[model samples]
Target chain A: MNLLLSSFSSLTNKVLMALAGLFLVTFLGVHLGINLLLLNNDGGRAFTAAASFMGTNSIIKVFEIVLFAGFLLHIILGMMVSGQNKAARPSTYVVSNHSATAPFSKYMFHTGIIVFLFLLLHFFDFYFIKIGLVAPPDGIASHDFYSRTLLLFSTPWYSLLYIVCFVALGIHLNHAIQSAFQTLGLNHSKYMDAVKVIGSVYSLLITVGFSIVPLFILFYRH
Target chain B: MNFTLKIWRQKNAVAKGEMVTYAVSEISPDSSFFEMLDALNQQLITSGGDPVAFDHDCREGICGTCSLYINGRPHGPLKGVTTCQLHMRSFKDGDTIHIEPWRAKAFPIIRDLIVDRSALDKIIQAGGYVSVHTGGVPDANTIPVPHEKAESAMDAAACIGCGACVAACSNAAAMLFVGAKVSHLALLPQGKVEAAKRVQKMVACMDELGFGNCSNTYACEAECPKGISVVNIARMNRQFLAANLLSEREKVVNISL
Candidate 1:
């Protein structure tokens, strides 16, 4: 534990966050693919089946637990890192003639707060509602995932909110992916171009794809 | 153009500091930020008031001497630009600009807007030098470096020991600055002789100086006047990790075997 604390305590939060973020990135790919099912004219069992499979699989259950821990750890470490940073430089620049120092996503403890709030509402409206814990108001088909998403997506304001959060996710991912590689020491110029390209593409897709659902649902009733 | 300035004035290290407001009238927009400060100083001199003492030299932006916390940013609003490079045009007709020095516990205020950045010097003293001591100037081409590596090394070497990286950094971490220094020397063949020990000493010095950890923020890169890459930070980390693992293993082998 002393060895662990000595070496890992300082950067442990960042390491955990990078790993968890990568996990969520993979999860995003799968989740988005499943959500894309709702785009179908003849909405098949793909959405429900994928959801059901993810819901029941023992391995997935374990993964979910890790995922939850990852999210919490990420937040906890992020907060710690941010707090230390704040204490390190107690005074802000007076007439800051300088450009931004940290990447927007890099210095985003405050932005993460916004994202965390959005995630809470998202989990409650979708996951919690489906899991039977959330006692949705009468007349709302909270359990029907498709109907639930459609309902939220149908409203312009709700769709706008999703768009806003998705934009934040883009901001978050743009910084995190490259940073994760940096933390892991994969920042050589030889492969850095490829990493940067992949990071940008991945961030763009998550930002554009996630927001598209709400826009599509809002414009075209399904 | 007339401008109002809110400058941070600290009497000494022990004294608490605050922003003191001063207005400058009839200023040319073409004047550099420091030049403008000089003009303000001239005005103060005429009025028998204390001149605002800030650190600056080689006003050409190479020496990295000018340290000012200009309006909530390190060098002022221009991205990838330095205070010396900053012109009055960036300001409006009547702008209320706040100016302060780099604030950190290690960088205690010496006077108004000037703190002792010798902590940086000490870190450099610890390991920035090569183990190979020079007797005299040798044939330059003897230590051959690839054009790309040489250029990159020079670019990293461009770090003027400016605490801008620390000032710009929200974490106030000297990773980019230190990384640039470490990489500048580490990348070259001449400095490679001491590479194993160089990293360990520099990192130790950095920690001893009371700077924060990097936290993977690239703000230092963005704000670096020399455009030092945050990738240098990664290079530094890899070097440190390698030194710790391989050299320490060799040490344990000697003890046990």
Candidate 2:
């Protein structure tokens, strides 16, 4: 109701970025758990049930709106933060040293862009198909999200792209997990080490968990 | 010690600047960094050359005026110490040291190795203090502050406003400096009343003045001469969030029977 809600500050922008980022982080876990159902030998039976529930559930439908809003806000705020950061230093140092900083921290924008591109391609491959804007592959039910995912992963190029994007996702999450906490003001001296450790474990889980599925489909599913 | 110095030299704030090399030999290892620079200045004056202009006051490290970006690190290759406190003994004989000014759009160069850090003062002016009436000091024990919060506030109060945090940060963010000021005052009973408004105004001023957002690089904390912890940055963020979210009073509705 005040100017604070309408206006922006550096901290406000960062808080938005962190909240949206953590929300997306939670979504990644849910997504990875659902996608892991692909590994079952029941020909996508469990995966289809879960996927249909996700697609049709009312609560999830509301969450989908929230999720897209989060993504949009995160992206817009990210771009503004990056732009302001760039403007803060118009001239580059002839010799800059970033040895003290985390190696992955420097490439956040690069990895984020890669992830964005991957998300777009992923949407085209699956989401666009579900909305009926694109035709489904032969012998696949229009609602058979599992067969389509399997077929997409079956392609060598598609699988390679997925793996590459997953690696980028891992790198992004590695810095982002702990960074989100620090941004959200959850950092403390006593628990800092634990936060970092948990962040790394979560990042690894997301990366390895999602990545193995594509490799499994590409190499062993036939 | 004999050392080759690559020093940035500029005639004025708007002039083009470049790194000029000078060799100084027979320097005492016991000489502080600023003393060595003084020796160099004497040699330059004697040689009829323009002496390098840098900022320094209270060579004992209390004043945050000695601003030097040395060897890609702020305040030379030391942690928890300012440029004035660094000694020549830290560098080996015949070593080459690079010195530059703290560079940022907000902190423009005033001269060689000197940047005008008034942008920090501006941020402080925005809301870095609590408004108070002119009156006698309150009894220290009257407001009982927990030992931990007092110690925490003191830790944050140690910030010297040296601008090293901005220079060390890859994005030239001033979050550490602003965080220190905000956190220090926010923790004290005298400062709690205005804490919400203070954080909001200070943060907005920081963004408006062209300081970047912190990405949690920890560089600011690493190169901070005062060793101000990023914990203060987190604390400032918490204050900001609380202010942004909870400071407003919502309107109450009256239902008719």
Name the best candidate (by lDDT). 2
Q: What share of the true interface contacts does each candidate keep?
A: 0.53, 0.67
Question: What C-alpha lDDT, on a 0 to 100 scale, does residue B158 get in candidate 1?
Answer: 88
Instruction: Report, for candidate 1, the interface RMSD.
Output: 2.9
- The TM-score of candidate 2 is 0.92
What does TM-score give for chain A of every model? 0.88, 0.94
Clashes of each: 17, 0
Using all chains and alpha carbons, the TM-scores for the candidates as numbered come to 0.81, 0.92
DockQ scores for all predicted structures: 0.38, 0.58
Evaluated on chain B only, what are the TM-scores of all the candidate structures, in order?
A: 0.92, 0.95
Residue-level lDDT tens digits of model 1 in A1-222: 223433443334455667777777777787788878767766646677777788889999998998887777677666666776667666555454344533575546766787888989989998888777897656776656766777777778888988998888888887778878887667987898798789889989988888777777777754
**TM-score between model 1 and native:** 0.81
Model 2 DockQ (Cα-based): 0.58
Question: How does model 2 do on interface RMSD, in angstroms?
Answer: 1.3
